[model samples]
Target chain A: MLTQRLANIVFTILLLIACIWFAVIAQGFEASGLLASSGLPSKFFPQLLLAFTGLCAVIIAGLYLIKGQAGGDSGETVFANFAEARRGLLMMVVAVACYFVWKRFGFVPMAAVMGPLSLLAMGVKAISHYAIVLALTVLVYLVFTQLLNIQLT
Target chain B: MYGDLQALMTALTHLAQPVSLLLLVGGIVLGLVIGILPGLGPPIAIALALPFTFYLDTVPSLILLLGIYSAAIYGGSISAIAVGIPGTGAAIATVQDGHKMFKAGQGGEALGFSLTGSIIGGLFSVICLALISPLLAQLAAKFGPREYLAISVFGLVVVVRVAGKSLSKGLLMGGLGIFLTTWGLDELNGTERYTFGSYHLYEGLPLVPFLVGLFAMSEVMIGAERVLNKIEFSDSSLKVKLPGLRQLSRMKSVLLRSSIIGTIIGIIPGEGAAVGAFFAYSEAKRKSADPDKFGTGIPEGIVAPETANNATVGGALVPTLTLGVPGSPAAAVLLGALLIQGLAPGPRLFAERPDLMYSIFIGLFLINILMMFIGLIAIRFAAKLIMVPTSIILPTVMLLSFVGIYSVSNSFFNVGVLLGAGILGYVVRKLGYSIAPLSIGFVLGPILENALRQSMTIADGSIVEFFNTPIGLTIYAVLLLTICWDRITALLRRN
Candidate 1:
């Protein structure tokens, strides 16, 4: 069956791996010379937490294996078809692009593009929608900088 | 009695000052705006206001953040009624019937009922708070470190169970959240845990930045998903019609019952507002003479959840103010605000400042009174909020979050943390993990570790001594009973 449930299962598994990696890192954390004996050593809580987290992931994975309800086979996939999934993925790409644009060109310039780019991502082919969205961006910028007196660099 | 009178006078004099009043109203208005805005919830609202408190006195600052918190939860209902989408997670339960009413051309009526129910619920919880908080404070004053440890376990367990659909998911997230807080130098023995040689890591990850990112940034990602797939929708009517006194009086039982239900649910460590709302709603439905009339744009459907959910604000505050333990995610952030203000929550607060307690009690009352007017005015413009595109809203909120986290410490590392937290929150949320346990775990982790270490030191490594205290044992017993709550309910149903 072509379903998002498989993807969800993979997602949880990745998180489990991330937790184990954090635990390994925690174990390597070196304690300073004299102060290690003040309490139950600093690594106790972090390692305990990691073990619990690992146990949880294993149980969750087991549940998915047996019941198939863990990753949610609710038949609620937004990307049930190719076109919708493409548009949604494109929107994420646009948001990431806007982040980089802000990093490079600064807030005002990136903000100017974000509104229209998002509209384009959603397949809104209307000039009116773009105009309205652009106007909103300018309005928000003015309110933040002029009215609220926040310095937008 | 003489010491009590002196403390009370000090409190009264402190609250009588003019700045406190301004902060209260300003906080409410600010909270309303943040609550109305999607992806911006109480944690971000409070975190953004955290630095402003560094200059102001503790009382006014606490009042400001508290007002915002209570009002924001109430404000979330506005967007939930106006649009099919909930403004905050707490309003999620409201969506089942709230959006239904909106579709049937009763938007104005639905908004009115929600506003009225919210105010009533808020007022009821405030009254309960005035009566019960002092009593709890009195009882908690006798507790020691071991007692606190027991209470911490009770609180953490209660929250983990109530937080999500699966207990393992809650445990995993909660464990990971608590583990992350151990990243700085240990306060007790001065041993570094996971600081990685950075001086900025000296104080651990700053609560304000972490909270701002967790609530605000995660929202940006979720908002982006909706942005690409959003359906255009709007409500035409802008007028709200108030329910008559007779109608309100008729549902007084429902309002009272739901408020109590909300308060009790909220008092449980992590049941939170959304859970309280639906629980109250279902309870009302089951008790109703005509259950079939439910969810058909009826007044009862709207009233129960709104009343119960709003009541939760005051209910949630009870544990946070009494113990350092937060009753909900919003209250957890409020705890952070209190800590930033150099005010430690717990029994000392009651002994040192009962007047501050009175102020919160009275403040909740005033917030409820103000809500009647503010909610009515706000209902008219609710449609405008619905029309705001989630795409633009998402980016703007992300910008605000970035600017806000940067403004606090002027450090780029904080911004990186915000982004990291956002991505982490997005992944966990997508994988069906609740953020409440994580947020609550982060807040409670330090307290838990401190109490655990101190209790161990005090007991000289004796495991039996840890649970030897009578007070600690009682709390443990109560917690045990709480965990078996589902079985109790099942037995009650079968009987």
Candidate 2:
């Protein structure tokens, strides 16, 4: 289980690094012609926001490091146990896989398999739940295709 | 007044159409169903319905979405009373007293009180919206870039203050949300910032898909993790029993006060229904003669939060329609729906589409009236909905999100954005951060950036001139006062 104290420290550090990188990249931004000289530069707002974000990330990381909890967390883990983590991470992967499947094989194949794949990811053993989810998938497909006149293919 | 009456007549003429009427009822039913399901809320309900509005006329679409907005808040109490779980965050305050009442075998009475109080509160706010919006719109119409900048700053800061326990985490998410908007071509200079050679990135990010994914898809993943949890509910106590006039009269003051509190809180940007509900609950408990009786199956406990939560629907729309600023995250999504209809929200919308404006006011009144009937019928079956396993809901919501988002633009890229946003939302939510600031900041980013740059140009590098406007100064003063209000109260109490 990943405790919030550890998670915040790790995540905020990565976020701070990303903010610095993005801010540096923002320096390369340039407007063409007369617009370049008109008012603030395009990088101004992004860099300002990056600075604010980086500052907040630093504060959060510092708080977590010093107190071991930022928001009254009471040193609780992010997830309760391994089972909860497995379900959550697996579902995320399934969601991504469903998106890629739609892009690769098209919406029909994706639609047919998404229900079963998601059911598997969630560790469901009920046959009726699978049937119901599949039925809902078909209903969604019909609503888009027939009622809304959306081209699914 | 005569013009208001004329517009009301025109709104009635439009709303009399069969399709509009059907969609309005359908929206309420959908909202009720979704709100009865644990882990789904008004924002998710509105987001999922946003894409369907693409095929609808402006009046029906707005009507449909408004129906969903109001009823979703009301429907949350059903599950709160029937089971221990609150179907929406707005219902969290209801759970203590509501579930207590259920366990005490007064569930029907509890449901009835919640339903009636919600209707009264909702109607009160709609009346307030109708009376106040026109005046607010007239005033807001005079706002300049500086005023808008002040308003945006106020919105973001207030949201960050109240969104999470850690101010830094909320600010980090809010800043991150605004920073992401700086991608694609800069509107001021047309300079490519971070398009990264993709035409899809040319628009920065699609608003509706990103928002829908953030609310709905994230919940789906969370729901997936809790799939093994089982809910047991008995239908025997599901019937609603209306309170008598005498019973209502006894609690009339509490109801009235809560409605006012909810409306005022709703008018403040970033203070959402959940906040209003809890605020009203605390206030009611403070004012009660037997304050210790709260959370012990009392009618006042149920009424305070239910009324306030429903009232927030109307209060939230006041700023959204008048100032082009959302009063709540749900209203932010509602604003996105308006943008999709090719209508820009703000003071001009009221002047340009008086009938549509009247439709919202009049339509809300009708929705509240109609909810009494629908809620009665729906409560009898709402128990079964609460019992539906999350494993079934997870897959269905994911599929709907994928196909619904794809159907919006017929573009796979938008779907990709949806998936990415869902992952981002899930990650932040798991790490003890609230997504309210993120969503609201994303919605307000364009306005904030545009206002700031334009204000800077108007000021010509003079900081004093940027704060020169009377309206801007007033807004800033109010923001400063709001931030210090708690400390001021604490000092007074000490004294």
Candidate 3:
């Protein structure tokens, strides 16, 4: 299990790297035509925010490095147990997978698969749970397509 | 005054329409149902309904979203009292005393107090909103880029200060949120900063999808973790028995104080219903004759938080309506609805749409009044609603979010943005960062960037001129004073 202290420390470090990288990318930003000499460069706000975010990430990293915790978090593990962690991470995978499914296979196919896949990922054993989710998906479909006239495709 | 009366009449005419009345009732019922179900709060509730609003008229859309905002906060307490699990974050403070009272067989009475307090608090804040918003708008009419810069900075700083336990973490999230907003072409220069060759990125990340993803999709992921947890509560004590006038008279002081606290907290940027409820709860306990009895089943304990949380609905609208700044995450979603209607939210909105303003005030008042009848009937069925398993809800909400995001623009890229935002929200929350500042930061990002650049141009490279406005200086002064006062109070309490 990943503890919050270690996770946050690593997260902050990665965030710092992203901020610096973004800042470097920001330097390449240039305005064209008559707007080239604008009031402030387009990079100004993003770079300022990058600097602010980077400074905050550095402070958070230092706090975790020295105190083993930031705020009152007290270095607890991020997930309660293996089962809970698996369910959460698996659901995330299912969601991302369903999005790709929608992209490749269409909305109807994605809708059909999403609920049952989520149920499977959560390790749901109840057959009725899958039925209820499917029913609700149909309801969402009717409401959006028929009632609101939204094109699902 | 006559023009105001005319606007009120026009608003009444709009509300008198059958479609408006039906939606008003439907929104309340839907809000209660969603609120009774745990893990779905006001922001998600409003966001879910947002796509539907894309097809609605402005007044009806605003009315629907406002009803959800007000009732959802009130609805959370029902679960808190009956099931010991707060249906929303706002109801978390109510669980200690509310559930205790339910176990002690005073469930109906506790439910009554929360219902009455919520309506009263909601009505009071609506009154405050009606009175204060116009004056604020009048003052805001004089605001230039410098004043807006000050207000935006004030909003971001205040939200970050209250958002999380770690200031650095909050700041990091706020910065990240604002940075994400910088993805589209710059309005000032038309320079494509990070559009990455997509015209979809021209308008920046779509607001509604990002918001829905952050609040709803993220909740789906987190809620998936405990999908099998069952809720149990007795239905025997579910009936609501409202207090008599005499009993109500006795708690008027608590009700009044909590309404004030909630409304005041609601007007501040980034403070939400949860913060208001906890603040009112603590204040009520501190002033109680028997503070020790607070957590052990007391009516005052239930009344304070429920009232304050509902009051935040009206209070939150003050900034959202008058200043184009959202007072809460839920209000930020409401702001999106305003944008969808092609109406800019700010002092100009008040001047341009006096009838809409009147509609909001009158509609909120009516909703609070109607919530009583709706809440009374709804509480009887609260047990069943509470029992609807999370396993069923998580997948449905996830599907709804997916379908809802796709429906808004019929764009696959927007759906992608929604999924990405959900993952970001999930990671941040799991690692212990509140999404309030992040959501608010995202909403305020364009405003912040515009204000800063404009203020810089207006100041002509002089830093001192940026702080030259009297109103801007006063805002900064008040912000400094608030921080110092909080620190001093904390030190005194520690001592």
Candidate 4:
């Protein structure tokens, strides 16, 4: 139930803070030897972009604070209901978990569990959907490993 | 001209091979299937297939991706007509009249007109690409750093302006995309920027993985949110019927005008297919005898957007191939595919690989022609594709993204970048920002930085001197006009 106005204000403030942090970090960048006297310093472009981005963020924050909308979702919430939010957030967690699983246990285990975990996240109850997804996961594994000679692990 | 002809012949000989022919057909089928699926568009389709291209020769790979590119744009119309939901952003304009016509029990006829118009628009744009690319490349060959800077600015600003309703939000995302590119060792000074002590970050974030994750993985998460929603359609209306020669002849003017509009818009860097479709649709409605009847399931309504959207494929390649600036977001991903092949796009490509250039031109023509036959057979099966449950697709796409990106380098870092990019894309998109400017900005970042540095060196910090070149001035003039066009129209209306 996050409103666009409230969300933009919060996001813009955080973005402004991040831009300042990155700009300070950019000050540490240095060049050596012949590259030292190049056309411009390495930090110039990034800092300039950060400045512009920060400026835009401030403008957006002001627009939202004053007008209460930025021309999208005037009075609507970010998600339709709790179910949609839960599904979306859980899917994101599942995706990240799959990545970590792949990194820790190799490709096979990750591929095997990714589908069922995702189906569970989406609240699917159909057994046939799981079967088809499992078959697809296996097919993908075989194609990459056998046909293309790619090392999945 | 004779050399071009010889190159075309060589390309024809290469495409006539059994392997190339099979990939071409396979690419079209894959493209159509992907296009018919809601939430999967050309960029994602090309991104998923990009890794497979790493295994094949340049000619076959480019041919396969080109088939996907052209057909995907055309394929979007199928779902637009059969259901109210457009499979791609380009097909949104088609839904106004296309879906209405389907409910009127003229589904087959609606599909036919869209298919025919798409083919015609696509073919016309290919012809334009063939005739216009060489000439444009000749002119682009003379461009200097300042000219490139102007072009990069024009491309970024134009894309940001059109990407969403809020300019500030779009610009913020665009700036963030370019800023991310500044990570790693600087190409100009070799100074470490934001590598964070990882050798993998030395060369900066990999393009293919970042792009694939941005388009495909983000859509997967978004699709996951609506997994329970059901798509309903009638299989009885899925048959496709080609319009008679007389029907096509009557709509000749609409087809030609839309083709021209699409191609011109496509040649303008960052305009994209959706803009072209909407513009052509508005123009068609404005010129009609009864503009009020436009959304009431008229043939002209379907034809304008369909033709223009497909035509953008050819038109967009004009800038992408000639100037190294992508004409659309899909073309931006196509640019990544080119970089993966170690082939840099621009005027240099035309000279260095005339055969490849010829192959693209000839290959596009073949894809459009072959799409008509393939679309006829494919329409009957589209209902099944359209009904694919999102729960199944979301996991499959995420898996593909992870595996496909990892296969690129066998590097876990690239996979991490993919996941990171997907999250960033999801957050920004959910906040009402368009991914078009971000993707395009990332692609243009290196070019923009290099050009800016070089131009500053040449100008020696003189701002006026940077604007002295005729070509740069011309590009800036066009950009200025484009920016002020709406304001000028508003002023005239007020007067």
Candidate 5:
């Protein structure tokens, strides 16, 4: 089990690195010609935010490392158990897969695949649940294509 | 006054269309159904319905979303009373006494009190919105860049302070949300920051799709984890029984106080309905002659939280409509709807489209009145909705969100943004960060950037001049006072 204390510390450290990298990238931001005279550079706000975000991430990492928690969920795991984590992570994968399917194969194929695949990802074995999800997928298709006159493809 | 009356008349004419009327009825039913379901709150309800608004007229679209907003808050109470598990965060306070009464076979009466209290509180706040918005808009019209900077800072800082227990975590999320907004072309200058050579990045991330993903898709993924959780309820005694005139009159003071508390809390940016309900609940209990009886099947216990939660609808619209700042997460989604209508929300919105303003005011009032009748009928069907399995809901919501975001602009890039945002939201939420500040920060990002740059230009490197405006200074002072209020009170208590 991944505790929140361990997870947040790792997450914040990664976030701090990303912020620093983005702030460095902000230095190369350039405004063209007349736009250069604009009151502030394009990078100021983003850099400022990156700096602030980095500072907060540093503080949070310190709190978790030293104090063992960040106010809530003292010593609690990120997930209730391995099953919950697997289900959640699998759903995320299903979402990304659906997006790629829709983009490459088209809406109908994506729609046809998403529902049953999602149920499978969640380890659902109930046939009625699959039927209901497919029915909902078709209903969504009709609402968008027939009623709203949208070109789902 | 005469001009305002004529605008009101015109607004009524717009709202009287058959499409508008039908959507009003349809919106309430949908709102009630969605609100009855666990894991779907007002923000998701509004976001799910947002894509449909692309094809309708502005007034009808707004009416549909507003109907959802108002009824969704009221609908949460029905589940709170029927089952111990709250359907929305706002109903968490209601479960104490509401479900206890249900077990005692007084389910009908408990629901009746919540319904009536919700209506009274909703109507009261609508009246307040009508009275207060114009004055607030007028005052907001006098605001300059410095003032907007102050208010944006105030909104983001206050949201971070109040949203979650960890200030640093909230601030980190808020900064990340705003940082993402700076990806597109800079509005002040033409410099490209993070467009990555893509034409779709020219407009920055699309607001509607990003928002829909952040709320709807993230919820779907999170909900998938609890696919097998079962809920049981007996629908036999679910019929609502309205309170007698005597019972209503007896609780008038409680109703009035709760309404005021909810409205004031709602008017403050980021102090959402959940906060309002808890405040009103505690206040009612504190003021009660028999405080210990609050959670033991008491009507006042149900009325206080229900009334305050519903009242937050109107109270939230004040800041969202009059100031371009959203009062709550749901209101932030509503702001996206306003943007989709090609209307920039601010004080100028009132002057430019008085009919629209009048439409919102009158439409909300009508929604409250109509919800009472619709709620009576909707309660019988709410049990079925409550029993819906999370496994079924997760995939269905995910597909709807996918199709809905794609249909909004007919672009796959927007859908990609949707997926990316959903994953980000899911990971952050799993790690124990609230999304309120993130959403609010995204909405307020452009405003904050423009105000900061313009104020800097005006101040010309002088920090003192940047703080020169009286209105801006006053806003900062109030913000400072708000941040220190707890410590200030503690010191005074020691004295």
Candidate 6:
């Protein structure tokens, strides 16, 4: 019971921190001089949305802290089991890696690593799966580059 | 009327071109392949084709996408009838009777009936589009910002209700989705919102990349979770045994009623093919002499939902092309395509480009006609294609995503966004958040913001004055009635 309550309180604090971050970001921004005279500047809508979202987050956090787990609607988490958590987090890493690789190297290099990297991330096995992935990649390259005439650097 | 006639003439001319003919066939074949594949739907099929459209003429490009849209919905039924797995959400209701028929050794019969029913429903709705779009466009010309606001609100509420388990969760996501659009420069005023300090943020989140990311990229990630699972189903009933005249005559009433139901539901902002289908199925069951025989592979049961669901494609397009409040999520994505082409959907579009509207009507009609022949040949080929390894399909699709999104802006940032959106889509779908609300919310967000801001300005900060318009007030009243229907019925039962 204490552990659950502690979890709720911590989550609420984290949400509150996120709200403060948004509020600070809003404050740090500048609205154009054209709309500066319009009483409600451009920041008005974003600030309003952020504020409301923050308030809701705070309320939800309060509910969790006060009433404990609030009836129903709980299901699988993003990191449910050990295998899933590792895969999800690792996939996020691979995605970032792919993005950077696409940035540094060309699409061809990114394409080469992306399949095997993602496959390895998902724990998919067999050498044939890798061949299938490579063949599929080459087919995509041929169609997009040769047929559709897209310039993929 | 003169403009519509001219547009029809232009469309006929466009269709005469060999490229358009080839594309029409190509799109239908592609749509069939997509529809047979589990976890891919019409939106992904269109998104994959979006980048390619950048290089082509508008007419051929649109015809190709429209072919994909119309045929993809029809294709999902093929899978449902054959393997008991619905290829798309719209075909879920079809699975009950369709798969049952397949299981009972009537696989060819079910496929035939479903394909025939789909064409009938699709053509019927296309006819409705030809007749009714101009009329609805005329009516929508009278709406002001307040009226638009009311309609948008109704859409959002309906979407939230239809989307998922928790109302608050839907609301939160919907709000978050809209709030993201409040970035970039304001349209009404030249002020910057939450653009943070990047030139890329100036345009806010780019529409195509954002959407493709949200729908396609997300789906890919979600597919990763279940990709390893052995999905094994085969149907010997590969050849289509289309219903004859007598069978068609017998199911005529079922076909007509479901078409009407589908068209009406399609007119509503939130409801789409799935809702129309399930409702038609239930109505047929309620009207039937033996309700218990519904899931027992009755032809009426299969026809009612399958036809209605396909009809919904046309029904959903009605408001999308006119009022600009998308009648469905798929229509919302279609709306994004319109915006990309610099075709702003509204009453103005009707007046300025009646020919384009007319062409869409005639083209949708042609697309459905071509779908029948395309479906006949492709369903057999598509079933065999399903045996194509997902390992190959996934990497190829991913590369297509890269090339497609890249070809649009020639930017790697957009591709990253696509991958990001795909991951988001995968996660939320796994979390049971229907991508419909998110997609609709994103499209409707700017419209909602502008309408509300303008209305408030006119109202002088008074909330009461916002409800001043007669059309707007009536729309709000209808929205209230729809939201309260379940609660009112529950209360009556208690009393």
Winning candidate number (DockQ): 2
Tell me the TM-score that candidate 1 gets on chain A alone: 0.83
**lDDT for model 6:** 0.77
Runs off by more than 4 Å, candidate 4? none
lDDT of each: 0.76, 0.91, 0.92, 0.91, 0.92, 0.77
lDDT (10s digit) by residue, model 6, range B27-128: 888888898887788888887877777777767887788888888888888888777778888888889988888888888898888889889988888888
Estimate how well candidate 3 is docked, as a DockQ score.
0.87
Clashing pairs in 1: none
What is residue B29's positional error in candidate 3, in angstroms? 0.8
lDDT of 1 by residue, B1-495 (tens): 124665567656666689887887888877777777665676667766765665578778877887788778877877777666677767776776777877888777777788889889989998887777778888888888898888877878888887777887788778877878888887876766667789888888877777766777676666555555554567575467778899899999899999999998887777788889889889989999998878766888889998998888889888898888898888888888788777899878877766777667766787788778876777666667656666556655655666555555657677777767777776677667778788888888898888887888888878898889999999999998888878999999999
TM-score of B-chain for each predicted structure, in order: 0.93, 0.99, 0.98, 0.98, 0.99, 0.96
lDDT of 4 by residue, B1-495 (tens): 226777777888889988899999999999999899988999999999999999988889988999999888888899999988898999999999999999999999999999999999999999999999999899989999999999999999999999999989889888988988899899988999888889999999889988998999889878888999988888778888788999989888889899999999998888988899999999999988889999999999999999999999999999899989999999999998888899989888888889898889888899999999999999988988888888888898899889988987899999999999998888778888889989998999999999998999999989898888999999999999999999999999999
TM per model? Answer: 0.88, 0.99, 0.98, 0.98, 0.99, 0.93
Q: Which segments of model 2 are wrong by more than 4 Å?
A: B1-6
- List the per-model TM-score of the A chain: 0.83, 0.97, 0.96, 0.97, 0.96, 0.79
Which tens-of-lDDT digit does each residue in B1-495 have in candidate 3? 126788889999999999899989999998998898988999999998898888889989888988888888888999999989898999999999999999999999999999999999999999999899999999999999888888888888889989889998998889988999999889998888788789999989999999999999999989999887777767789989999999989999999999999999999988999999999999999999989999999999999999999989999999999999999999999999999999999998888789999999999999999999999999988888898889999999898888888887898898899999999999999999989889999999999999999999989999898888999999999889777997889899999
* Clash totals for all candidate models: 0, 0, 0, 0, 0, 5
lDDT digits (tens) for residues A30-59 of candidate 4: 999987997899999999999999999999
How well does each candidate reproduce the native contacts, as fnat?
0.40, 0.87, 0.89, 0.81, 0.90, 0.32
* CAPRI-style quality class for the chain A–B interface of candidate 5: high
Model 2: C-alpha RMSD to truth?
A: 1.1
Q: Whole-model lDDT, candidate 2?
A: 0.91
TM-score, chain B, model 3, is 0.98
Give the 10-residue window scoring lowest on summed lDDT in candidate 4 chain B. B1-10
